[model samples]
Target chain A: MFNIFKLAARNLRRYKRRTLLTSILITLGVVAVLLFVSVSGSFKAMMIGQITDSMLGHLQVHSRGYLSSIDSLPLHLNMKGEQVVRVKEILDGNDAVEAYSMRIRLGAMFSNFTETTNVRLNAVDPEQEMQTVPMLADRIIKGKKEGLLAKGEILVPELIARGMKVKIGDTIVLVATNKHGSVNGQPFVVRGILEGISGPGGRDGFIHTDDALALLRIEGREISEIAIRLNEMEQMHEVFDELKGQLESSRNKMDKPVFEVHTWEELSPFFNIARMIDLMTLFIKIMLVAIVLVSIMNVMVMAVYERINEIGTIAAIGTGPGKILSLFVAEGFLLGLFGTLIGVVISLITIAGMNAAQISFDFGRQKGLLLSPTIASGEVIVIAGIVIAIAVLGSLQPAWKAAGMDPITALRHV
Target chain B: MTLVTAKGLEKTYIAGDITVRAIRGVDFTIEPASFVCFIGPSGSGKSTLLNMIGCLDPPTSGFLEVAGKDVTHLGAKESARFRGDHIGFIFQDFNLIPVLTVFENIEYPLQMVQNWPALKRKQRVNELLEAVAMKDQGGKFPNQISGGQKQRVAVARALVTNASLVLADEPTANLDTETANRIISLMKQMRDEFGTTFIFSTHDHRVVKSAEKIFTLEDGKLQQQGNGDNHV
Candidate 1:
């Protein structure tokens, strides 16, 4: 076996130019794949972080029919106070739950004295909401990041703030209709202006939960939704499953399930874009496979064709068919190994250089967000394994043809 | 005892609708350590007979034995193993692996086929290199060496495994007359030193003159068999 490998290496060296060219082709393919994966992976991670950490959290719990009518912020479908307490108990007891914020979602009329417009609002406990969505404070492009909001003060969306000419310290009136046929209004000062996110929740305003209760004249501690954060985002599905299993069994007096659980993927439109990035990454990988397959196969076939007489001599002198096959395959395997090694080294250096350069770009209203591209070691291993395997697969046909050659005919092949 | 025996040996190749008989029924025996030559014109069954006798090809119909084993109907793999264990081959082109140095080419049979140990294989290759007077050319690749030197390396390679029988098909076809005679003499000397049977096919009268026994083939049939001068 060692002799076979030695011979195979020498054979590759015999055609130095061809071997180098094929190796370069494979190396470029590998570098392209690794770099694309790292950059696109960074983009996806940043996008998800913006949506989840600033708005949705990792997952959320809502009243059974609430999400279907979530666009309208239906007040009658809010989880009653008892259901909130039950859900709170489940969240508190689960180790995976990092923090959760209970919100009162409502539609209101906003007027900055001269201008009036419809605004969607989320009333939250400032401390809990901060803990669940830590980046929420970072989204405040103007005004206070510290307290988020105080009672009788609101954080207006940037679009609304711009349109209504509302600013920090500007007093605004919010009018709302309760579950009953009653209307109420409250005046509040703007504490901050939020940078708008890209999707559905981008235009919503924020206020203190106490102010929402007072404005709506709610009799009990009913809440519209619970936004949950987990210690590890990768475990979102497991935690969602565990929590949903428990919550799904909890019924109202009418014997119907009371809540629905959703991951941030389901709640955000940005996820489709994330999936498209993933699909593009897959297509890049397929392209890498095709590149390796064609290049290695072409080189191996040529090697066999050019060395037919040598193959015949060896076969006639007692080298077996299996040995011939392995010799060619080993050459291909070495090609892949060398190319992958070079490509991985170059890719890592390129990624490091990107980080050192501190590349930054904007997504939606988030600006100067630095892009830090990274690849997991497992991903590198998998990609390298795929290239080497494909190289071997590509060499099979040519190697088999060499192995099956009749020495008499091969010697006369010229 | 005979190293090779063939009774009514024949070979036929079929291509599309054509059936070509390259070797007609013929019988022969070769004694161990003997120098034998087959002299024939083109398409006179010289290479076909040698291929069958070397176990590189199985006869279509015959009773054939080499070193006491019937090889007329051996399977492809078994035939390859048989060839590896019992025979060595040298080609007219001095078909050395171009990538390998002369020493490595000579060591190939032992290393690839017989699974010889490194030290022993090195010793055997060195001995053959010395015997073939290519001791100084061990590190030169085929193209880097002269045709005579390359043929010398081929001779060394064929004897490296101590094979009981060595087959050469037109071993001197590419060499000058003097070089051809020298290669033939070296092959005979190796046969004497290793006690190995050497069977070769050639159109060179000089090569046939040095052979102890010669068989003449005409139209796929052995027309005559005798001592070198008598047969000619």
Candidate 2:
């Protein structure tokens, strides 16, 4: 085996240009597969990180009617103010719950001068919301926490703030629709500019807890949802089970009657679509690998045909058929092996350079999205294994032909 | 003892609709260390008979034995291994592996049949190169060498395994008279020194003159066997 291997290696060197070209082709194919797989993986990781950490906590508890609302009503979870406190306490006791908070989501309109736009407003506690969603603090571009706590003060999304022409310290009219379909209007002062959530359709505006209650004329109303942030995204089910067990054992009638659970995966279907896209990207990668396999097979066929006489000579000189087969197949395997290594190195370098350049693309719907590159070691191993398999499979027919050749005819073939 | 003995050996090849009989009911023997030649015109089956004796092809029927092994019914790979271990061939056109240098080409059979150490392989290759008077040209590829020099290297390559028989098919048909004499003299000298039997096919009377025993082949049958001067 070793002798034939050395001979095979030497033979490859004889056709230096052809071997190098095949190696380069294999490298390019491998890089394409690795690059697509890695970038899709990175995109998935980034999107999940954003959702689980900054927007929807690991899970949320909402009222059944509130989830599918046809009529505009305050279908709150109907947990009393004390019940909200108790639920938060129960969640905070669990090890999986990194933090917990409550929010009152309402639909309202913000008006400044002559402009008015409908906004989904979230009224949250400053202290607990900071623990559940750290981006809340990161979004505070101006003003202090003291000012955000002042009644009748609000912070607005950058897009809505820009359109409303309402800066810090400017007063805007807030109109809230009550459960009876009547509107109540109140004046509110903008406290700060919020940033970081950049899509065109994220929630538009946010007001403080006391100010939103006054505008809606619901001073004694219960909170609508309980949001829990788990330390690990994978722990959502475990924590939900724990929460359910706690609620069941407690004498909490309201918590049992109206609450429903949701993880971040359910709240946003974008995560699911992102996962599906990742699978599709892998499929495309497999197709490219198949093309590489075919190219290698073609090269092997040419090589076997060209070396027919030589194969016969070697066989006539007492080399075993199995050894000859190993030799030819080893040539193919080495081709794939060399090609894959080159491809991996090229891909890593290219991806690194592209990432260093910070290249961004205007993907229309996902404008200003940056193309990020990433590949874990495990993914590299899988790609290498796949390319090797393709190379061996591609060489099978030609190697068998070389092995089965008749020595006399081959020697006489000129 | 006779190194090769055959009786009623027959061989037929099918080419499309034409079934060509290259050898028919032939009985022959080649003694050890003898310079033997099979002389005939084209289509006389000299090469075909050589192929059968060298174990490159199987005889169609009847008893055929070389070095005491019956090869009439041997399988393809078995015949190949048998030929590689026991026989060396010198074709009219020198069939040196073109990609390999002369030294590597000579070392090929040794590497195939024997698990010799690198030192042993190097020593054997150099010794054969010296015997062929190609010591200085061992590094040259077959294409880079002259026709005569390539045949010298081919001789060295074939004899490197120390096989008991060397079959040369039209070995001198491509060479000038002087070069052919030199090649025939080299084969005779190698046979004398190593006790290697020489069985070659040739039409040149000059090649036949150098052989101690000669066989006249016509229409795929052995017609005559005599001493060197009988044809002359």
Candidate 3:
């Protein structure tokens, strides 16, 4: 068997140009698909990272009814007191949850005591929210990112600051209605100017949890939701599943589901765009298969055609039909093997070169999105296997024809 | 012993609506370890007779035997096995496998057909290379050798498996007269050494001159059989 494969290998050396061209065709296909899968996969992953790591915090825990009317900022539907502690127990008990932060999101009117505009406001625990979304501080263009807003202080978005003529250290008043439907107002100092975000609901204001509770006249321990960050994005669903099972399993003192769980993919609308990129990668792979199938099959047929006399000679020398078939099939398999091997080596170099080159693109509010092509070992193995399998499939017809040839006729084929 | 026996052998071809008779009923017998030649003009069924005798093609309507085994009805696989075991073929064009070196081509038949052990195969190939005076050219490819040298390699390849009957179809048609005579002399020596019977389908009189016995065919019919240029 080894001798046959070696013999088959030498056959390629007989037609250097044909073998090289065919190998190049298959190599191009493998390289193209591998690189496309890796680079597009990286782009998709990076975009999801922007939403999950920087904005959405991977998973969110909130009341089932809150997300439905979250646009209305219904303060009455927030998690509070013992229920918050219960959710914390569920979260803290699980190792997948790296961190969780509580936020009280509300709609409020922002004014310089003269010019007034509606703004979405999030009242957050300074330390926890800052840790959960570290990029938020990174986007603070005009103030220190080390600490969150202090009591009687707020972080104003540049959009609103420029519109209302507010700057760092300026005093501003926020007026809002509480869960009781009563109106209230409070004075606060602008501690920082945040760079404006790009997606929906990106322009917002951040204030201390105590300031929000005081302004809303809430003496109780009610909050909007718990935002969770996990250690790894690849394991996002596994963590989400574990979190879901524990929270949904909470049969209250009476058998009622208290909290709903969601991964960033569910909560962020930008996730749909990421899914489309993955689907595009799938299409590119199919295209590679077509290119390899056509080229490899084409080359095998020509091989059989050119070697008709050799086939006849071997047959007359008592080589069985099965051996003849195997001979041609081995040729195709070798073609795929060499092509895939070269393609993978070249693709690895290409990917490393790409990373070293540090190609960049701007997507939404994020700049310099790195184009890193990442391939798992399993993916390379599978790609090489598929290309070789296709090579064999493409050779089947021609090999069969070669094996079925009548020696007398083939001997005369010139 | 009778190494080949054929009685009423026939072959026909269908071309569109017409049936062409390539060979009419023919009868002949050859003895073991003899150098025999079948000589005739073109279309005289010389190759057709050799093809039938070598198990390359089945007889259309007759009983034929080679090495005392009936080959008139052998199937494709069985015929190939039988040919590998008992028959060797030398084509006019010296049909050597171009990819293989001279030694590899000679060793190929043993590997593919007889399943000879490597040491035995190597021994036989080396002996034939010595016998053919191609010992030093074993590493060269067929294209690297001269026409006569290529024919010598083909002869070595054919006999490497130790077939009982070696069939040479117009083996000397491509060489010059002197080269053809030399190749015929080489075959006579191989027969003396290996004691393998040889049958030739040839148009050249030089090959006939070297044969101990010659059969002449005309229009697919046996016209003469003689020993040492004497026919009844």
- The full ranking of all candidates by lDDT, starting with the best, is 1, 3, 2
Please tell me which model should have the higher DockQ, number 1 or number 3: 1
Q: lDDT scores for all predictions?
A: 0.92, 0.78, 0.86
- List TM-score per model, in order: 0.97, 0.81, 0.90
**Model 1 lDDT per residue over A138-191, tens place:** 999899899788899999999999999998999999999999969999999999
The list of candidate 1 runs beyond 4 A from truth reads: A253-255
How good is the docking of model 1, by CAPRI class?
high
Provide C-alpha RMSD values for all models, in order.
1.6, 4.8, 3.1
Q: Which residue runs of candidate 2 sit more than 4 Å off their true CA positions?
A: A31-44, A57-118, A123-153, A170-191, A195-201, A204-266, A272-280, A283-287, A362-372
Residue-by-residue lDDT tens digits, candidate 2, A1-414:
677777777777777888898888888888888888877777777666655556677788765556555134263434566666767678767888888767777878778969999877778777677788665655566766443445677878777887778788898888888655678998888888776452311444567777667776776756777778888877778878777766655453565444566777767766677879777977877786787678778888988888877876777666767777888788888888999999999889988998999877653233566778788899899889889888888888888988888877777775
Q: Order of candidates by TM-score, top first?
A: 1, 3, 2
lDDT measured at residue B219 in model 2 versus the true structure, 0 to 100: 89
In DockQ terms, which candidate is top?
Answer: 1
lDDT of 2: 0.78
Better of 1 and 2 by TM-score: 1
How many steric clashes between backbone atoms does each model show? Answer: 0, 0, 0
